[model samples]
Target: MEQPWDYLRHNDPAAAGILDALANDRTLEDIDRARILTAVDHAAHDLEIRQRLTAELTTLGSAAALHPSGLRTLPGTRFATHNMLAGQVRLGRVVPTANSALMRAGDFGIDHDVLRTSLMVIGPPGSGKTRSLAIPIVEHLALASLAGKASLVVIDPKGTDFAYDDWFDITIDPLNPTHGFSLFGGATNADTAADRLTAALLPPNVSDDKAYFKDASYNALYDCLAPYHAAYGAWPTVKELLALLRASQSVHDQVKAALKGTPGAKEWKEHLDNRVRQSQGSHDPAASLVERLARLDRPALRKIFDHQHRFEMRDINRPVRVRVAIPEADYPEASRVLARLVVSQFVQTASAPDTNRRIFKGLVIDEAGRYVDDYVARGVQKVRSNNAGIVLLTQTLADFPPDVRPTIFGSTGCKAVFGGVDPETADHFSRWFGDEWITQNTVSRGQTSSITYDDRTIFTRRSGHSEGHTQSVSSRRVERARWTPSDIITAVPPGHALMALATSDGNRVGPMLVNLRN
Candidate 1:
């Protein structure tokens, strides 16, 4: 019935023929004006369609759908079953794309390549940022599991986001309530525990001012490591890491003295006791400690067992990435530190001769705006080229320190912004992308002189554009670009987003609505 696709194959002779073909179909005349206008608007505005048409279509070649392979790498959220059209957009289903999958309701054929530039989904609390990101984490891990690869490293601030309890043949471990000969103490047999402790205690953020953390706080470091040793039952499991820390802490007494302090010693002892109490409520201190450590370390311990490789040993099949989620309440600083450490260490580990093959490790830090703003900015600026991607999530502009927003956006290769009603955040973001679009119009009326005046309908002149997030990157810089009055009024519920890609050839790909979950 003279559809958009039909225009490709007809211009003059064929156009008349197509018209004739549709002439017999009376129903074809009933097509809605609104739908036809929408199509025309899309053809005019959507950059992806424009590029494809320019590149592939000639006088002879038309009517064919644009292939998805042409999509250049851009950060986005993907759904399992592509939601090509609206599916009862509900608050519960509305969320951001957590990891790196971008899906639209219909089949646009955008290539689902392994994401390069990491994603940062910013919104606000209850904006569904975490859940949106978590789905991708679980799905990506599942894909890795299927491929017989370990591809995810989750450093959860809450520790319960992605439950791998029975899913991956992996273990879940929390560092807490452990006691006895500490790894931070440098006991020869406790060397392994010391190493694990070192790995655990290595702060994610390191400054020149606090560079001597290794030597300045040995006992505090030990207390931090205590949770790990307690979790593993012995320090030997992480011996090599201990050796590295030993070198760093060679002259440190802060750790030793801190451990020896009366209160410190008592707290340490009681922590050990709590481990035991967690198990079966034991009377014996050591026994109680053992049980408690078991409970806390069980997950991490189980993960170790599943790998079929010792901590210090190497395995070709071992997953290079691992995600650790610890509640902010348990060890807030540690969560951020662990995130930083893991990224830095993985990059370092990838270059090390023996571990170099395990080079492609990544870390996804959710709600990062609350904790590691500066580190995230620096990490995004430097890490991607090293084959290490860091995906950070935050729900609001206020959630992050205000001063770093420009740097954060500048350093990030991929930027994703979800829903926020706040004009401060949304409007600030608009400057980068464009603006939160609002339609404004002035309709003139014709008047007739009667007893009063008769109202006459004049045309409504439309002005302004739609608002959505857009990403721009060149050889020299990166920024979040927005579009003003980008398009018409399209109602997008949660879990949905309009994305735009600025590729090399002066083409702006979209501001397409993409769905990440179902």
Candidate 2:
């Protein structure tokens, strides 16, 4: 009787060699024979050395290049066994030691570089963008302090969105937030202070020829009005402010027109002149207008013209604390304005130290796409020059302006993409890793046994062949990713996402399932 090895010898001499080698030490339960088998099996399928080399380079190839198809295969679903094992080892006790910033410096995978760039986390509403991005930033900041690195200044939308008062010595005052140790000076209220500082810090106009009033009027209006709206809970009507301006100018013009048109204009002027004499020349048209505005209780003039305050800044060395406006009322405009102001302040204040190499700081903005305008976008673009990092959180790709999108995406360097429901957004992101479209053709064989009608006697044979094709989107790249909350653990439906670190050499490292803390 022939042993199982006889069939191997006839069909695969290479497999027989490895099996014979293992037989000498039958007690050995080693993978050496399996490795040899796998290699041989793979090599046998490729007729030319080209397919084998391609497979080696891409880390994937099929047996019998034509058994599958004559078509050439690209690098897809490729992985480095050595790096994955290394990453598994480095990921030891990551969850337990995840509270504060923890730095592990070693080769996480093959040719893998350390993560030196800032990471941006983006997700839709209720998708936990705050947990994924802000928490990581806080953790990194906490860990950096231990490493003798700089701290973090998070520009949160609300004063209470993030809870780190006990974790790190943080100061939060939505009404009175300041960078370093600066506060609003010469301001009666929080709104006035924020307005004053915004006006003072940002450039008044785009050019020298333009008046600051004309050029920065909208921003100025935002600066002045945002605080009042945030504090008093109302938006100063734009139409109303415009109406007041027009009314003031109109009143002056009307008085001039009335004097010119009236036959008794000289008499009226004499009457006003007599009144001025009665008040000892104290009465004037400007005074009269002021009295009228005061009596009418115009909030527009009160917010801007009445509030002239100076913003306060603390020391450059102090830990940056952002006091976000309260979210008591739905303040979208206030949110946008305040977000821009805080971002500008963080960049200017922290950047100088970074340029001097004194210390590094990080600015974290959650839901950034909602608030970012041309002004905020420009500020975000310049953050790197200040020697600081920025993390912008958004859900949709369309959240950002087209021109600013590339810069924001490129600057992020590291991106943590959570699950997205929007297929367009998903497809857009899928392209970054270079997804390959796979098309497959299938052939089916069926068997039928039956006797024909009259003369076809007993013998029956079954035979049938059928074919079909299929197409799919499969990523050639395999990455190490942690299971995110968006992926699972919320009692919600599951989502498909692969976490990866895009190394400096442009290789992805994971699909490592990570857990998002509830």
Per-model TM-score, in order, reads: 0.45, 0.44
Q: After superposition on all CA atoms, what RMSD does each candidate show versus the true structure? A: 19.6, 24.6
lDDT of 1 by residue, 60-133 (tens): 13222221222111124433322112111121232233111242335332211223245556655665666755
| Residue 408's lDDT in candidate 2 | 63
Per-prediction tally of clashes: 51, 23
lDDT by residue for model 2 (1-518), tens: 44344444664555455456554765542222232233344444554543353343233322212211122211222111222211111221112211111323223221113232345566667776575435545544433322223445565665566654433444433334332222232234434444534443334324556443332333333333333333334333333333332334453233435456545555544433433343343433223322332432333223322333322332324333333433324544434444555565555554443343333456667767655545445555454544456667777767876766766666555565556435555555455534322222222223434332122233455456424433222223323212323332232222212234554334544433333432
lDDT of 1: 0.40
Clash count, candidate 2 = 23
The CA lDDT at 13 in model 1 is 44
Candidate 1: segments with Cα more than 4 A from true spot: 1-105, 108-114, 148-150, 166-172, 175-321, 333-336, 347-360, 370-376, 435-492, 500-509
